[model samples]
Target chain A: MAESEYILEVKNLCQHFTSGRGRKKLTVKAVDDVTFSVRRAETFGLVGESGCGKTTTGRTVIRLYNPTSGQMLFDGRDIAGRMNRKLREYLTSNIAMIFQDPIESLNPKMTIEEIVGEGLKVRGNRNKEDIRRQVVQMLNKVGLVEEHATRYPHEFSGGQRQRIGIARAIITNPKMVIADEPVSALDVSVQAQVINLLNDLKEEMGLTILFIAHNLSVVKYFSDRIGVMYYGHLVEVAKGDDLYQKPLHPYTRALLSAIPEPNPLTERTRVRIDYVPERDHDYSLEHPSMVEVEPEHFVYCSPSELERYREIIQNA
Target chain B: MIYDRNNLPEELLNLPASDFEALYQEDIKDEKFQTKPVGFFKDAAIRLTKSKVSIIAFIIIGIIIILAVVVPPLSPYGFNDQNISAKYLPPKMPIVEKLGIMDGTRVLKNRKVSGLSDTDRYPEGSIIEYFNVVTAKGQEMCDVRVDAYMLAGMPDGEYHWFGTDYLGRDLLTRLFKGARISLLIAFFSVLTNVFIGVVYGAISGYYGGKVDIILTHFAEVLDGMPYIVVTILFMILFGSGMVSIILALTITGWIGTSRLIRAQFYRFKGREYVLAARTLGVPDRTLIFRHILPNCVGPLITRAMIAIPGAIFSESFLAYLGLGIKPPNPSIGVLLSDGQSVLLQYPYQTVFPAILISVLMIAFNLFSNGLRDALDPTKRGEE
Candidate 1:
């Protein structure tokens, strides 16, 4: 990715977890040498199966988890693993996150007002009146009324609650948003609504986004560029439409093929590539490594396979 | 109850029976179901109100407080002054009498005395003396003043309402005075404990690693020492004054609160909302107090209610052992010790104070248990 065009850059980020007993300890490489960037006004989707460390990568970029190694630059300032008071306030004001589960993501006990206004309270040292005014405006912007401010999370529908969550995330006027499966928990109809809302806000605010999900079809529709992860390694990265049309990596190809096609005849022609589920297999050794298969396309392949893949790409 | 033709418009109330039944059921459930108001503290308050016993106990305590503050000053007698001459008398009983009718034919009889006999019966039926006595035939008579031994240091002519102690202090006055000290000790000790415990536990739980380890070690060290021993050490160091007792009681009281607050913090700190706060750049203080503490406050308040009775009982136990409040400053503990000394001769002294202590302690315990039931967020569904 071009450095100047990026609003956020994550470089070679690694997060490791150690488990098992005594000398027989096993280490799980959660986010191994993952690299991607969100351009100034673009949606960057991260796709993988469960346990692919996509969530871990998003968390690390926001510095919720201190990266074991590597760097994350938010607007050209390295934020990974280094948190100060000012940096925390800066992050709160500049970047925000929308979570997966609406029920769990919002605190059950707080009112809509307290929940949405919390970001502002944390970011700006404003008086109470100003916070309330801003909270009301944000709530109205998210299609909630003034009366809803006093109501609790349980009072609202799942979709409405997610909107409240979005209102909370955006209340601080963040420049970038890390939406971690923001719509997956809602009903299918509600999912489209939330996605549309996010898209509208993205355009209106000129925001950068890191949208993470397990669904390839959803990301294909929503993201500007897509990065495909297979067991903690970035297997491929390309323009969303290009990747959907002509995926270069085997994992990406299998993922694209799995998306249910609308028409029967063309769907039948779509290949079903049978392989081990990447989430179940331990892919630690394959990580901390990647090969440039083609211009702007990277894959984490073994040395022997890397040469073969490079040859194929060069001929193409 | 709409009857419509089969060709009626669909909008003209042709709903199915099941739909009507479902709507009725929903209405019924809505009427009966308990709903929690949003916001942690308000929800907690609603929950807390559900405990009938806590509410009653709180009222009783409030009445006691009013009496402690208002009624004592209204008393005709002071709390401390001793009338030594009237010592060791029994509880006062109201005396009613009518002099024998003396017409012109009957000689007028003086009902004041049977010439000051040790026997409880006076010579005439008109003069009533209230005392418990053993007759010469060995029957117990509670109506007339006869046995001199039961009267203790009673002078020849006086009406002592509710007999005095060995030092001639009024029992009622002493009881009230003792209440003042015992309750003060409970309140002050609880204040110190909650302050220390909430701060200590919150910081340890919030920061959780080196600070937690260090605090845990400190709490463990304090926990290892016996409560009485700790109290005695403080008493020796600071002396057995009200301040010293408060200091001693609070020294060990906070451990329980710390454990409770720490548990609450641990339960809530790792939740998604807290992590979200951290990601949003909400400072540590706001996260700890605004987000995290409110989650924990329900339990903390409940635990504090439970701790008050414990503190009161501890002070009482210390006083009963003669290590608590000293003589001249009547705590229930000191009164209890005094009662024990006189229990064989005057069981009422021991019985009244002991009963009061037990009643107060039990009331507080029931109240605290009710608070715990009401304040727990997990119990919201039940409410």
Candidate 2:
């Protein structure tokens, strides 16, 4: 990939959280040695089952949680480790998160206008008239009327609330948006609507997205490239179409096989993939060494298997 | 349960006809609904209204306050003056009985020596004596030796309305006067404590982490200290007075309130709205006072109501030990202390004040309980 094309490059990002009753400490690797990058105006889909550290990876990349050890380069600037107050503020306004739960994410007392314009307010864009105009315009773009802006979050339907959440993320005009399962909470029909809204916004705002979800079909349509995670580790990374047609990793193949075929006449038999319940033994302290198995395709494999996959891909 | 506008409960949607659409628009659109109400007054009022018991208690307390303030000044007798001759006088005891005691003249003549000579009747000395005495009339000496304790002759009246104490002071007047003193101390002590607690708690909760640790430790240390010991220490330094009692109660009283406020602050400080405000660059003072403190009002007001009765009880306990309001001032504790001897003879003196105190306490207690229920935010489903 060309150097100028990459907006965010996450390298070997690892976040370990300690959870235990007392005296004894147990470490859960929330995000383990995960590496990926988003090019300018490009969407990178991160797909994994729940508890696979997908959300943690997104949050850490946004600096909500300081990673145990890793490097994150945004606009070619390394912003890992303890951030200064000004730097933190800059990051908040520059890259925003669209949380999964719209009801919990939006404060119960605030009006739609305030919720949508919260990003602008946080950035100290205090001209009330300007904020009002911008918030109304953004709400309109998200298919909400100006009157809805004055309403409380509880007054709106779940879909409308998600739209408000989306408006809040976009109001800052951030270069990148980390949408963590943004539509997973909505109904299937509403989910489609939100996904389409996100796609349209991505194009209109020219925003790079790190769309994290479990829906392979949605990710296939939303993202240019996809990364599959299992047990806190990013196991495979490939182009969206290429990954679906020829999935290299066992986990990705299982995940893709689970998606139902829409064509009734295709006579497809669903493939059941046994998900390995990740035990502490499943991940050792020693990190899996990653290898470029093909052009623009990376996989974490055992040291001996790396050259084998490289040769196989070369021969193919 | 999602309320379809058409199926909304009447009580739930009891907004004034004029405000229906307007409030709906504001409720649906305003950021405060998402952020939480800015000030506590609205929510506090709402919570207070919901508690039926609290409202009743409030009414009872209001009546008690009115009685305490208005009833005493109208009384004819002074609270402290003693009429030795009228000692041990029962309430509504006929004038004939008082006249008969005076008619004998012998009991009055031997008042100092004859009264004190008896061992069982007068333990210390006969300040007052109750026994039958003969009158000067030869027909049938029927003058009664009324056990009336007083400093001087009884006031020019038919008889004692509530019986006199050992000092021959009017028991009814003293009770009323004591009620005033007790209630005042309780009111002031609670006010002072709540003020201190809110400020202390807000600071501890808002700053959190290291600052929280320090304040929490301070609260813990204070909490661990025996309240009785503090009262004694303060009494020794300041001597027994209303001021001393108030100071003692309030000094440690605020610790509980502070702890409560601090806990509330911790709960609310990291909420999404608080962080949102911080990001918006809202001032720290506004965030703490406008955003966080309102959430605490329900608990604070409820606690404050309950604490008043507690303060009054504390003052009474101190007075019972003679470390509260001094002589010339009446408190239920002081009245109970002074009435121990006369309690056997003229039980009304002791019984009346004791019962009043108990009833007042019960009323206040019940009211406080109701207030607490009313002020709970989670239970405040109604307006």
Candidate 3:
């Protein structure tokens, strides 16, 4: 197979978790048949309400959680099969994850050097000086000094720790990073600092990031293309501007309306859209699947709703 | 909570976007910490030093340990030395004789006044005073206080600081020596218990489900077994010595440590750092020992400290039950058992050992409590 421009392609990815057995067997489809693609060196922002499978999709793509049934292609190689040592090595080496909670992401017992240098160490780089040098360099890249490498995670603030998390993730020189809500637990001022840092690092390293977050505005600003998810389904996919200008799915529209505008004059006039799927879509008689509403814009809708969305976009 | 130049949102409802503008534009360079970095252990040590109760307890423990090491060999009497004639000798000190406390005095009651004058039965100048006299059946019975050392035919300048036992073993020498054995047993058994417990609990707690259930149930069943019965089994198989006794303590002792470690692993294995390590492709062994285990070291160390006293007490109890370290080999419990038999006659024998054991127990208990407080992260930087 020829190499595709898209670095990671996940098709019909379903991650279902089952607990107990026999009479009381219960299954939770956290990510049910979610499909999306991340191009090489582009930020693919996934925005949703809490428990909408955004984090699960990112984890599933990174092979943290094994997909229940799907086809995931990383660099044109199938990764959605049974995990072996070789497959795990390939996945982890190419893809690193940045956790949400900065305090929780870094090990408290370890120094910054150990935490950041771990990927290299695990990959069989036994030279101490080499690892230390690289760790120091990575720290510098994240605007940290060599002295900071000796300090523990608890010594640093939330934003600093998140930067350390970023440094640790990208230090291994992974092609793709699954940043799971990297700035949800930081102050607004600190949030901008981290985001700017991530933006700079992304440009420098040419890293493809599957940025999963609930905050729509950050996702909109950071992401080149954005996918909106409702429940366990991918509701819409479009460019950042297209997603803002014309949100095709009702759920996406509802998520968009929730973003508080900066202008007080416009804020008062803002209409809140509540997405009641039962009231919005009638899928009993008609079947719906992901459809191309316009070039570079996709929405999950039945025929009647697709026509309506098309008319809305044309009018806009 | 997104706040950038374009995506400010309503976070700045009261404040202006310019407030965050400087932070967004500025590069992320972290400031150097003003104070010196305090590591977890250094932090704990600092906190521990601040607790005066712990400091005093620590000093007492240190003194006891030093005496345990220094007192036995330097003493005039060996641990098992038998001066058959000098059995039940009262405590004596040279300078203290003027004050009359532990001055080797014994009150002789129901002694006939005629017998008191007899030099053969009562040594010459041994009788100090006749406190009470009774005349009955034309016989004079008197109670006189005598210098016990002179009564026992001990030479001048000879003294027994803690007196002697029924076997004429110096109570002070035997007590310290027994403390040595008891402490060693506690140290060794605790080491073994923690090692076994950590490994067992790591596996059980890290790998939950059927394995955890089976291992947990097995530990419960073993926990149900009578420790006395287990000790008895060890006595039969290995015979009672330091090894057998340590094994006896270890057989069931590790269950608590294992339970502690298991619970700790259950708490820490799911922590985000462990997950981060897992995502980094850190192997299972590294995850278990390095990632999750280190996080719970404070609690583990405290548990081990508490377990030291527990092991010592268990050993003492076994010795009291007549299953202690073999005869002539002194343990605190063995000495206590021997002293309790002659408790009424020579309460001094029981008193000295009893005091040392109580001090040891109290000191250890206090030390562990202080350690728990010191190591507790929640109480960090507090008084």
Query: Best lDDT goes to which candidate?
Result: 3
Scored by TM-score, the top model is 3
| Model 2: residues with Cα > 4 Å off, grouped in runs | A1-4, A19-23, A109-153, A260-268, A275-287, A302-316, B1-52, B67-218, B238-244, B258-297, B325-342, B345-356, B375-383
For residues B1-383, write the lDDT of model 3, one tens digit per residue: 22234434666555865676542465667777777877889989999999999999999999999999999999988889989778899887778878989999999888899888889878988988985788989999989999888888888887888898887778888899999999999999999999999999999999988899999999999999987887898898999889989988989989999999999999988887887887889999999988889988888998998888888888889988899999998999998888898888889888887898889989999999999999897887565
Rank by DockQ (best first): 3, 1, 2
Q: Quick one: ranking by TM-score, best first? A: 3, 1, 2
- Compute the lDDT of residue B122 as modeled in candidate 1: 34
Error of 2 at A54 (Å): 2.0
Which prediction has more favorable lDDT, 1 or 3? 3
The digit string of per-residue lDDT tens for model 2 on A100-125 reads: 88777777656778777766765678
Best by DockQ: 3
What lDDT does candidate 1 reach at residue B204?
89
Off by over 4 Å in 1: A1-3, A19-26, A257-272, A277-289, A292-295, A303-316, B1-50, B93-162, B381-383
Tell me the docking grade of candidate 2: incorrect
